[model samples]
Every structure is written in C-alpha cells, then in structure tokens.
Target: MTARTLPGMTTISYPPKPSPGDRIAVISAGAGLPGLLPRPFELGLERLRKEYDLVPVEYPATRKMGSTPQERAADIHAAFADPDIKAVIASIGGDDQITVLPFLDRELIRANPKPFFGMSDNTNLLAFLRNTGIVGYHGATVMCELGRPGAMHPQTADSLRAALFTSGAYELKPAERWNDINRDWADPATFEAEPETRPAAGWTWVNADRVVEGRSWGGCLEILGWLLMADREIPRDLAEFDGGVLLLETSEEMPSANEVFWTLRNMGERALLQRFSALLMGRAKTWSFERPNGPEEAARYAADQREAVLRAMRMYAPTTPIVFDVDFGHTDPQLVIPYGGLVRVDGPDRRITVTY
Candidate 1:
C-alpha cells in the first residue's frame, strides 16, 4: 500500500530495493519444507544465484520443521537486523504461521524494514509488516513460484523482478494461459517438465464505469479470517483501510463457497467490507491433491466461488468495483501483488497497475 498522508496516521513506506549482488534471506516464515524436500529448494537457490545474481542466506529455523514461534521470530529478527540481508523471501507457506505472530518484535522489524516476499499462510507476516508500516509482497515463495517444475512463468518472474529491483507503477496483465493442477513434489519425475495449462479466460469485471486508485490491503481469505478471529494486526480503528484496494485469494485447501461468503459477510458485519475502492479477487484454485476434479467439476467450483463473493459484496459494498479471476493466486503464472502498495484500477479501461 502507498504511504497514507492522513493526519496522525503512520505512513507505510516501501523498503529499500535489493541489488543483483545483494544478499537476500531465504527464510521459512511458515513450514520449513526445504528441510523435507531439498531438490526444489536447491533449484530455487541456484536460480537466485545464477539467474537473479542474488546471494541466498538461510537462518537456523529456515529449515527446521515444527520450529517454535520464538525460533521463527528470531530468524525474522536476524534477517532484518543484518544490514547485509537486503530482502527476505519465504521458503513456502504453511498453516501455523499465525502462532508465530505473537513472538514477532514489530518494532525491531519496523526499524529494519526489508521487502518480505511470500503469500498463502505467510499472509500473517504480510499483514504484520503492513501494520508495522512496511509494505510486504503478497506473492512469490521459494518453493512455489521460484521453484516451479521447469522454469519460472515468464510473467511471474517479470512481476517479481520488478517488485524486487524497481520502484514504479507496473501494469498487471491477464495470463494467456494458467494452471492449477499440481504434481506430487515428492516424485522426482515431477520436475522433468512444466505442468500442463489451459487457456486463460480474461478477468471478469463488475461496475466497469469508474476508475479507482488507492493503497491496497488484504491477502489469502482463509488467513485473513484467522487474523480477524485472533484480532491481531488489524487497526483498532477500521478507518485505516478507507479508500484502499482489497486483494484477496483462496488457497489450495479450497474452502467451500459458503465459507468464503460467511467470512466476507462477517467482515461486512464489522463494517470493514465497504471500505475499499475496489476488490481484486485472485483466481480460485479449484484443483487439489485431495479433490482433483476434471474440467467440468473445476468450472463449477470456480463459478460457485465467484457467485459467493458477488453475493457478499452486493450486500455490503454493492457499489464497489470488483474484478474476479485475476490470475494471482495458487495458479500458474501467478502475478506478484504489492501488499500495502498503491494500485490504480481503471475499470473503464479494464486495466490494473500497482506500484512496485
């Protein structure tokens, strides 16, 4: 999100960018899957060094599964405190990152702000950083985007590169093709080729008559629900999000349409849903290991999720502009969204641009 100039409010600033030769911390803010599955993590590290020309540094808890909150917090502290560490990227996302929130020293992180990159359950840390007045990236993790089977999706790589090394308005485009089906990471053959993909359906827009520009705020819907439940990170005064853009996406766990509706309905009940100038809903990830539906089933799932979101917004923020199936979730060619960054939604032109 862009820096808010409102009186008596803290300005959320973009952290300094990292140079190609800079040292970037590869920490596990969530699960230390790197420890369990080394190939993809190693591949990702090689890319950081060879392709991106950045040095990857790992901390103690970065590879220790079941790491305690205090341990993970310590790694976070060390990464930011070290002047040599120019940026921090999560290894992957996991379920229990919220437990680590209490152990974080917000002031320490704020004092040494670094661009933190991650999504999924790492939404906990992203929201934490925003409250601390540092803009965290809402996409790109070591194992997911960085360690994709074959090569990075050119779009994902370009978006991430811009986010890492530049500061300017970057236009977000719809992917020509996208994939949600995943192969077992444990299988050695999975890395042999890129996953199959389907032709992308362009984003669907609602209220396409206006242009809305504002600082952005929001993350994975499930994690957001958890934050609301724990009552953490969110401002005591909900007005902080007034006129901001809201970015939301679901994860591979694939919550039902009812679950999505109820969570957003609860936000509406809190008087929080109507605050945004626009909503960017990431494409629903319909296929999962547990529920690998074919084309027909997947289509139905996506349609249901979209309807649920529309139903909630119709009740709470009927006039708000919403664009659904924006390809930036647990799908291939995931675009990087700046968490707490400036976004310009030109609905009349059907274009989206975010400040990197």
Candidate 2:
C-alpha cells in the first residue's frame, strides 16, 4: 500500500436549532419538476408542515420548469441570505446544477450560512458549500424523502430526522427493504400507495477487518468528474483527501462499469484514490426511464458495478475497506449523509456511521 501523511479535512461548524414554526426555504436549484408534476411536490411540502413542523417557503423560480442558472442562483442567495429561513431544501435533482454553481454569490452565502439538503445534481452545490466551510447535507431531497409514496421510508425518515434535529454520531444500516423500480408520477394511482420493493441483498464488503474514521468528502462520482473537468471546487493537493471517507454514487444515467473504472483510474493517476482510508459506495441505481431493466438484469448491473469498484480499489489502495449498496443516492429509501462531517467505517463490526 502507498503510504503518505494525512492532511486534515476542513471542519465546518453546524448552525443553531430551527424549531417548529420556523421558516425553511424550498428551492429548485436543479430541475423544477414541481411545475410539471405537482403530486409528489405537494406531498413533500405537506410532510414538511405535518411531520417536521417547519413551514416551507418557496422561491419565485422554484417551480419554474425551465429556470435559468442565474435565476436558480438568485433563489439560493435569497434563501441563504434571508435571516428568517433556517434551512434550504431542493425539490429534486436534475442534470445541470453545475452550471448554477458559478453564479452563486460565495460571499453572500458565507456571511449567512444555513443547512442545505440535496443530492444527485445538487452534488455541485453540496461540494460548493463544503468548500465554503458550511456543512451541507448529501441526501433527503424534498420530493424523494418527504414526498415518498405511502409513507416516508422508515430508514430515510429516521436518518433525515437525526440530521435535521440532532447533532451526534448516527449509525447507517443497510436498508432491510429497498426499491429501484419507478411509478409514473403522472398517474394518480402512483400517489395512492407506495412503490413495490424487494428484499435487500445486503452490503458487500471488501478488506473488512479494521475500523477507519475520517472527515467525509466526495459526492456523485459523475458530478465529481464534471467538477474535475471544469477545475471547480476540488483541492489540487491529493493530501487534502487523506484520512477522509470518500462517498461516491452513480446517477440514474447509469454509466457503464468500464466508465466507472476509468473515472477512478484517472483519480488514481492523479494520486487521489490512495489518500482515502475507506469508501462508501452508494447502491447502484439500475432502473431509469431510458433503460428500464428487469429484476435479473438489474442484479447483473449492480454486480458489474461492484466488480468495477473492486478492480479500481485493487489497483489504487488494496487495503481500503469498501462497503457497497449503501442507500444514499438515486435509490429509494435513501438516507441522509453529512457532507464534510465525520464518518466512521467499522470494518470489524461491519458498521458504517456518520455524524450530522
């Protein structure tokens, strides 16, 4: 194994409490699907009011389907800069949130920091917030968590509640039941009940024996690739990632195993892979509108993705423990992970936990 001194990841202090009756901003930093389909969006808002007991405030462009990057950035600034808004939540993930990153007013956000919640395309903003020394949340998008059909997934609800209300170490458990199949949001029946789920195959572990704890880093692997290409928020020194738990997930676009391996290989060439002590691989998202896979095909796809991850780890850091099929990405029952927060990877105990 390659040996190097570990540099400490930057720490961002969490904000004060936002109790019931406080206002939270709800913005669509990526896709404004709320305009196209209001069922899930409305349900998500209702849950914020009933379950969380916080009022959700929306922006002018929040529900606009084709909102421009400047418009979205304005909403972000307004939400963060406002003293009344205690938190900000994205409606859903989209394809071009990277474009909105450049337009963000860093000084404005730094002056007034609040907890931000999102994932997928929101990876761009999460990374941005981390760079700004603000602890942002990696999961729990409004539509996916609050608006979940039938009821909130128990795992998701618990994780999100802890991340939102409490501040401490929270253990992450592999979802006992998980779902990847989609129900059409356009169909009213889809909102009448929860989507079908299959028994979880459980997490796959590699190099299990020791415990590794570190500050967290990384986001959707695809989004990180874009950030690297654009020379965005990533630190130039590989040492910046040392002693850090790198969390990565693939988006619904479903890049092939070869592509995933190539991405990690490039990072390895840059001397980035060996710096991390452990990896949390988000459960592979197998089904999408473009390429809908059956159960057997979906299983194969997930297995292939795991093999690709192992191949890259073998070439980079052979001793690093990896826990796979974590439900924190494009999968249903997604748990919230704290970006730039402390994560403990207990290989001996087969437990993964994060401090939010």
Candidate 3:
C-alpha cells in the first residue's frame, strides 16, 4: 500500500495493482444474477481469460441469488486474504450491497489490500474500502462492462485494462460514440450484437475557468443516498470530503429529476457540496427496459437530470467547476475512475485525467 495525501483526504493507500497473468476474484458480493443470467457473466469470464489474460476465481456464493450478507462478506474476506489473488472484481452490482456492509472485516481487508474493481451498488464497498484506507475502483464490473454484448467498447476496454494492470497518470477521453440503453441480459440473442449508440459530443462544462486537482470521492448517486440514510460508512468528519473532486452518477433505475434534485439538495444541506473543488457528473442513463423512452423523451430526461444537478450546485456550490456527461456511470463504454485516488480536472485545457 502506498500512503498518499490530497487536499481533502487523509492518508489514502493505493493497493498494489495486478499483472496480466495474475488471478482475479470475480465474486457477486452483492447479487448473484449470474446464476439466473449467465450469458453475459460467462462471456465476461471468457474475456478475462482470453483477452485480458487473467484467471477468474469465484466464491461459493458468487452465483447464489439470495445469499445472506454473512456469506458474501466471507467471500470478500477470503478474496483479500488469499495471496494468489492479485485483484478482486464484482460479477455485477445489486441493490442489497449496502446490507453487506456490516459484515465486512475491515481490518482483514485493510491488512491485505488488493485492487478491487466495481461500481453501481458496489459503491458501498468502494466507499468502505476508501474509509478503510485502501483505494477502490469506481467502475468496471465483469458482467456489465467486460461482458458487454458483441464486444467490449474500445474506450471501456482501454480504461479497465489500464486501471487493472498499469499504475500511472491516465488521461480520460470522451467516447466517440456511447450508449445507455441495454438489452435484456436474460436473452442470449442480446449477446449477438453491440448495443446501438449515438455520436457523443464533448462534455458540458459549467464555470470552466481553472484546473482543480484532488482525490476523488462519491459514486452511484442512488446508492449514495441509501448509504447516507443508513448512516453506513460515511466519515463523521465531513472535512474528509473538503477539496475533493465529487463523483456522482445515477443507475438504470433512473431516478426522476425531482428525486435527483432532492438527493443533491439534501447533500447540500449537510454541507457536503461546498467541500468539493470540482464535480464530474456522469452521463445520465436515458433508457431502461421498463422506460423504453423515445429519442425525444430520452433527450428530455437527460436534460432534466442535468438541470436537477445544476439546481442543487447553484444553491450550495455556485462557483465550483462542473463537467457534465462524463462517461463513467451506468452508461455503456464507461470509463474507470479511481475511488480515493488522485484526479486532475483541467477546465482551462478541457481535460480530465485520473491516476490509475
């Protein structure tokens, strides 16, 4: 573990990164949707072996849909405690991840830290690892990004590979094309073609006049709200967030504009928003199986979500720089962001880079 310091963060330890041939743990620490929908999960494992040259080790509970928190927590402990496992990755994200928090052996995890990759509901574990002194990755799960239909997006593949094998400063680039709409993973046919995507414009900037560099924090906006309400692993000292770059994105659940506004509003009320030097709001996922929005409605939905974010920022962090539509959330072609790791947001040069 390399102990480092940023403006707002105390000493954060970045766990040693993995090499190409190292063994990686693929555990469904939150949900075992893999048992029900193995198409994507199996494809992801194949890619890990063939494309990435990493072997995946699964726990007994990895494919058990209704495993208890204790069972999942045991898998986590085992993954970290194993000397042969160079890294740990989640099979996918799920809503009940927050419930698994209490069962984690923080000391065991901290003592044997290895790069842990995940996002969405895995945000809970990411936040926990951050607090426990080990930096956790904020993107890339097996079934979602690696197991992407047809093939992994080149942009996403590049980001995940770097975050996994290399450790250095990596500059983030906007996706040439991107997608948030997903097909049913349950249907094997969905694996036959890549999801359709539209050309992506550059990220939107608000108050883009200066460059800000700091440690990154926050993830999966809805999961964050759950963590906050449950008073899970949030630091008692709000100062821990001061001068950090805030990272926030919603899930496929697609919370309404009003819900997004209220969540951020509540964070602002807690005096949290004002602590960040800059914010990276990920591209809002506009379509889901249930919503199946038309293009017009999808455009409106993204716009409204943007407005909702700006509304809360205006109230609590009026002048803070913000770059919207970063491709690092539930969106396809997602980029990996380091949790509790250094981020340099260059507004003047219109660049965003992360320390992988």
Candidate 4:
C-alpha cells in the first residue's frame, strides 16, 4: 500500500484495482433490501457477470433482513481475508451501518487492502476504510444504479468500468439528461421500462478562477454528521484535511434547505470547511415517495439547497472553489468517485477528472 498525506491528516493508501477475471464480494453491509426486493439485486448480479466479467460472491447475511452488526462484520472479514476476492461491494445502502463499524477487524482489513464500492449509508464503511489508510469508492451499488429499470446508464456503466479495472485519469462529463425519480422496485413493470429523466442544465461553478487538485474525502452529509456525533473515523487533528478535495452529497431522505445549511454550519464550526481546496457537490435528489414533488417544486428544492451550500461556504471557507450538480449522489446516472484518491478540479477549463 502506498500512502499520501495531506497536511495534518494521516496517509491514506489506494488499493490496487481488480482484474476482469477476479472475484468480487457483494455483501449487504447495511440493510438487506435485496431479500425484500429481489429483482433489481439479481439483475445487478447478472450485469456484474455478463457486462463487467467479474464473478460476484455473496455472504450468508448479504440478504438477511434482520442481520446483526457482528454478522455483517464477519462477512466483511471473510471477503477481505480471502485472496481470491479481489474487491468488495455493498448490495445496497441502509440506515444502520454505523453499528457495524465497532465490530470490524480493522487490522485484518488494513493488512489485506482491497477496493470497496458503496455510498449513502455505506458511507460508514467508506469512512472506516479511509481511516484505515485504504481508499473506497463512494458510488455504484448493486440494486440501484447498476440495476436501473431499463438498463445501466451508459455514462454510469462507463464510469464504473474505468473505476473497476483501469488505473489512470478519467475525465468526467455531466449527463446531457438526468433522472431523479425511480419506479417502484417491487413492481415487475418497473424493470420492464426506464425511469423518466429531464434535460440537464449542466454544472454550476463557484470561484472558477483557478484549478485545485487533491485527494478526495467526505461522503453523504447526513451520514458524515452521524459519524461526527458518534466520534467515529474523523481525524482529531483538523489540519489532516488541508489541501484535500471534499465530496459532498445528500441521500433520498431529501433534507430541507435549512437542514443542509445547518449541517455545513456544524462542519464550519469544527473548522472542517476550510481544510479542502475544492468541493464537489452532487446533484440534489428532489423526488421521493413521501415527498412526491412536481417539476416546479423539485426545481425550487434544488435551488434552495444550492443557495444553502453557498451561504455556508461564504461564511466559512469564502475562497474555496466549488463545483455543483456533480452526478454522483442519489440521482440516476451517477458517477463513481474515489474516496481518498486523487481528483483534479480544473476551474479554468470547467472540467473534473479522477485517478482510478
């Protein structure tokens, strides 16, 4: 493992990528949504084999709804220790992954570092991996982006392909159109058709006068807040984050504008906001079952959240460069971002690239 340090932070290692023929472990480290809704999960497995050419191995508790934290941790241990399993991925994200952290054998994982791919509630494990000096991926789960209603978005598939097998700089482009609403996974008809999407307005830039390149950190804001509250994997020395790029996104819970502001405010209060040189904010997910917002309302919600972010940045890290509406969070056609790996945000060129 190779280590790179950013100011006060300890060094983080980027684990080697797996070959095409390597085996990948798909575990339900969070919620076992796979058991309740099997169509998307099974489709994702098929894609991993035929589309990506990687054999996916599942654990005992991968689809168990009421799995204990220790059970989940055991699966993680098994996946990491086995030499044949070259990588690990989460089946889906859920609410209680924080409980599994304490049960993890950190030394065991660190000794045999392998790439881990996940997001949302899986943020818990990603953060844990980061602190262990191993980089993890922050997007592309089995039952979500990979198993979309119609098929994997071309952009998402391309991004996942590069992140999975290649080791080089890959430029990221905004999808000409994007989807935020998804069909009911339980309904078989959902798999027969594609989700609806609207045209994209492209990315919005702030402080676009220069370029900033650094290792990536941060994940789902709500989950990060939970980690901070529980005093989990966050570094005690604030300067560790200096000169790093921050990756911030929200989940499907659709937090209000005020909630977004306060979360940033809390990070600012801890002096965490000023550490990063740039921020990559994922496009806000505006629609959900409980909050079935119309187009106008969804637009307003996104606008409000953007304003909230700007407000927080101005109050704290006034000069930090920020790129908004990166297609990597809860939205459809998501891009996979490397956690604790290198990212180049070229403001003058209006481009973003990640090293796989």
Candidate 5:
C-alpha cells in the first residue's frame, strides 16, 4: 500500500535493480516445497542462472519444509543484509506466511532495501515491504512462473527482465492466450513440456470515461483478509488508501463467488472500498486439481467471479474505475505488478502503465 509522505520521512523508493552476473536471493519464505519436490525448484534455479544470468543463493530455510517462522524471518534478514544480493524472490506461495510476519526485523529490511518478487500468500511480505518504504513485486514466484513446464511464458520473462534491470514506465498488455490448470508436480513428465492453454478473452472495463493515476496497494484477497483480521500492516486510518489503485487476485483454492462478494462487502463496511480511484482485478483462476472442470464449467466459474466483483462495487464504490481479467494473478503468463508503485489507469484509452 502507498505510504503517506510525512514531513522528514523518506519518500518511497524502488529498490536497486540487479544486473546480469549479479547475485539474487531465492528463499522459500512460505512453504518449503523445494525440499519436497526438487524437480521444479531445480529447473527454476537453472533458469535463474542460464536465462537471467544471475547467481541464485539459497538460505538455510529456503528448502527446509516445516521450518519455523523465526527461521524464515532469519533467511529474509540474511538476504537483505547481504550487500552482494541484489534481489530476492520467493520459491512459491503458501498458506502460513502471516505467521512469519511477527518474526521479521523491520529495521534490518529497511536498512537494506532490495527488490523482492513473489505473489499469493507472499502478499504478507509485500505489504510489509511497502510499509517500510520499499516496493515489492506481486508476481513471478520461482516454482510457479520461473519453473513453468517447458519454457517460461515470453510475456512473463520480458516483464520480469524489465522489472529487474530497468527503472521506467512500462505498459501492461492482455495475454492473447492463458492457462489456469496445471499438471501434478510429482509426475516426472510434467516438466517435459508446456501445459495446455486456451484462447484469452482479453479484459473487461467498467466506467471507461476517466483516467486514474495513483500508487497501488492490495494483493491476494484471502491474504488481505487475514491481515485485516490480525490487525497487521493495514493502516488504522482508512485515509491511507485514498486515491490509491487496488490490485486484487484469487488463488487456486477457488473461493466461491458468494465468498468473494462477502469479502469485498466487509471492505466496504470498513469504508475501504471507496478510497481507491481504480481497481485492477487479476484474471480469475477457475480450474483446480480438486475440482477439475471441463471447458464449460471453467468458463462459468470465471464469469461468476466477475459478476460477484461487479455486484460488490455497485453497492460500495459505484463510480470507481475497474478493469477485469488483466493477466497478473493465478493465471499463466502473469505480469509482475509493482507493489506500492505508481500505476496509471487510462480508462478512456483502455491502457495501463506502471512505473518500475
């Protein structure tokens, strides 16, 4: 979320970029799935070295499953403290990152700001970094994006490269094709080729008459709810969100359409929905291993999610500009959204640009 510029307070900073041949930290800040499933993790590491031309360094808890919150926090400290580590990326998202928040040393992370890349439950750290005046990336986790079956999505690779090495304005485009379903990671053949995909429907825009430019906030809706419940990171004064752009996405767990409505309704009750000038809703992920639906069922799921969001907005923030199905969440070919960075939503022109 955007931090207020108090007198004498340092302005929000985009952490230093990492160049080719520079060192980057790879930590399993959530579930240490790398220890349980080595194939995808190894593939991601190879890509970090061969494709990105950056050295990948792992911490003690990076691959250790069942590691304590203190252990994970220690790894984060070690990564940021190292002058040689130019950036940090999460191996994958998990369910319990909220627990690790209490153990983090804010002073250490603030002292050595670095670009951190992750999404989903890693939203905890992303919000944490923003409060410390550092911008964190909202997508491109190692096992999910970097270790996608076969080659990485060209769009994902290009966006990540820009975020890593450059500092400028970059446009975000809708994916021509996208995939939400994935094969079992335990299967040896899952990594032999790319997963199947379908044609993209592009984005749907509401309130296309005005432009909204502001600093961005928000993340996975479920994680944000947890943060709100724990009373952590979120500002006590709702004014902290005024004129901000809200970025939200769902995970593979697939909360029902009604659940989505209820969550946004809670935000509205707290006077949170009306503060943002615009909302960027990530493409809804429909299919999952537990409920593998056919094409028709998947399409219905996505439509339901869109309608649910629209219903909530109509009640809470009727005039706010919202663009749906932007490719940046659980969907394949994800874009790296700059958490707490400036985003320009040109509704009249149907374009989005983010300052890296």
Candidate 6:
C-alpha cells in the first residue's frame, strides 16, 4: 500500500545525526534495576561514553528502584527539557510505566522533541511519543542492550549505532546465533562474557508473494494489551493504522500461547488487526527470572507462540505477510525499531529493512 492510503499515520522524521560530544540522558521511567545491579548499568554507561563518544547523563530517579510514577514523569520531563541532551534512553523496562503516563506533560515533551530509546515496558512511553508526533525508538534500553554481558551483540550494536548517528534505511537481518537461555546476572562470572546463544532457527514468513511497506506501530504484545485495556494512546479510529506495519514481541514474563491468542482476538474485535499489511513478530523470549527453560522447552515455547500468532492472523488478517523470529523485544541482542518510522517488508526477497 502507498503512503497516501494511510491517514493519521504520518511518517515522522528527526535530525539525521547526533554529534560525538552530544549528551544523552538515561532515565528509569519504569524499573530502576540499575540500583540493584550495577554490572550491566555501569557497562552500558561506559559504552555510551567510550564507544559512541556521547556523554551519558542520568536523572534523579534513574537509579532509585521504587521511585513513584510522578518522580519518573518528572525525570522524563527534565531529560526532554534540557536542550543539552540530544537523546534520551531508558535505564530499563519496568512493570508500571503506564502509571507514569498520566503524569506526563505532553506540551513540554512536544516543545523539546528529541530521540527517545527503549522497549518492553518502555512501550508506554513510545506510544505516548507517537501521539505527540515524535518518533520514539522501541529498543536499546541501557540495562539490556548497553549492559549486555561480555560485549554488545554485534547486530544490536550496529543497528543502534546507525539509528543514533545516521539517517537512512537500515536492513535488519536475523541473528546468525541467538540466545533464549537466561544467565544469572547475580553471579559475578556472568559479567565476564556474553551469554551462550544457539544456532538461529532463521525467520519464518507467511504469504510471501508481495512487498509491504509503511510506518511501524506496535510493541511488546503484553504492553500493547495493557494499552488496549486502559484505552490509552492507541488511536480511537482503527482505520488510522491502515497500510501500516504491526510489529509485536512478547516480554520475559512468558505469557502463554492462550494469552497471546486472546490478546489478538481482542484486537480483532476492535477491528484493529486487519489495519496492517504485515506483522513482524520478534522471537519469543522463553527464559526469565522465574522460569529458566532448557533448550528443548525454549524451542517448544517459541513454536507455540508462533502457532498462536498464525491462529490470530488467520482469523483477523488472513492475507497479511508475517515474518517471525525477528531479533527484537525481550530476547538477547535486541534490534532497535523506530516507532512510526518507515519499515519495508519484502516477502519475495525474504528481507526486512527498517528506516530509523
């Protein structure tokens, strides 16, 4: 579908580059796990300073684990209002960023529009920024991407570097090797090197006969469900998403396949499922703090999640193209996606390219 076909889904744009000396604010809009575990947080900060050549700044609530929603909102406003800060990154995703949404000052954020990066629970802020006509990022939380054990995932590093410093179309490739297994960060040894990853199962595509391109919308499925239930930033008119691409991923919470189906079924009822021409499903994250699945169990979990997605698409968007096992969301080596940015899904070529 051409861009003209989609109304209310404008292709948002931003400055092409952030200079080396630029200052980027790091805030914990949701969880301040940086307070509890400094391993990844410190490492992430170092990368921002040493590798990216950008100074990393933190807000008052950034490292406070139990900070209130109002405090988090205050930090967000402070980060955006500061003209010296070129971009904002979340320290990590938390469970209640939605609660902080009501306290956000839309006018302030709009006045000082800058790049904001995050994912998972950060979906709340991403949706908020989208409504404000600002294109926010959907991946690269400091604790997850920057503080990744050992070294940054190469694909993730390259994707983020391009997103932060360049303005153009960047192609996304499935990870050659991916890890769904969890490593305990509490153990000091986990920080010495990267976690183990198995061979990639590659991307699974459906209805691969045509090309579809549009502005991307959607985030962690569970977070999207919350937004739906709360009737938050999602456009009231389902047609607003027509011709757009719907990108979704599940978090570490490991919601069951039944849960995934039920969430999509509700979206179908809202008449929101068919608005998109294609769906990009990030690989399911099967391992978490509560349950660490073995390789066999992890494979089953990913398969079940895919089956659930197929079931939903069959009922709601039967002809839409689908590419599964994308490297985004709660998995290791997450790729940054631009919320409301241009994304092209080339089914025939078996490729996906995102313009950030």
Clash pairs, model 1 backbone: 1-340, 1-341
How far does residue 157 in candidate 4 sit from its true spot (Å)? 0.2
CA lDDT scores, all candidates in order? 0.91, 0.87, 0.91, 0.91, 0.91, 0.87
True-structure RMSD for candidate 1: 2.9
Residue-wise C-alpha lDDT for candidate 2, range 313-352, written one tens digit per residue? 9999999999999899889889899888889999988999
TM values, all candidates: 0.97, 0.96, 0.97, 0.97, 0.97, 0.96
Give, for candidate 1, the lowest lDDT window spanning 10 residues. Answer: 1-10
Instruction: Assess candidate 6 and give its TM-score to the true structure.
Output: 0.96
Model 6 clash count equals 0
Q: Per-residue CA lDDT of candidate 1, range 1-356, in tens?
A: 22121233457999999999999999998898999998889888988898899999999998899998889989999999999999999999999988888888777888899999999999989888888889989898998888999999999999999999999999999998999999888899999999898999889999878998988888999999998988877777788889999999999999999999999999999998999999999999999999999999999999999999999999999999999988788888889888988999999999999999
For residues 126-209, write the lDDT of model 3, one tens digit per residue: 988898888989998999999999999999999999999888899999888989888888887898899999989869999999
Off by over 4 Å in 3: 1-9
- Per-residue lDDT, model 5, residue 99, is 88
Query: How much is the lDDT of residue 116 in candidate 6?
Result: 90
lDDT of 3 at 170: 96
lDDT of 1: 0.91
In candidate 1, stretches whose alpha carbon ends up further than 4 angstroms from where it belongs are: 1-8
Candidate scoring better on TM-score of 2 and 3: 3
- 1 or 2, greater by TM-score: 1
Global Cα RMSD, each model? 2.9, 4.1, 3.1, 2.7, 2.6, 3.8
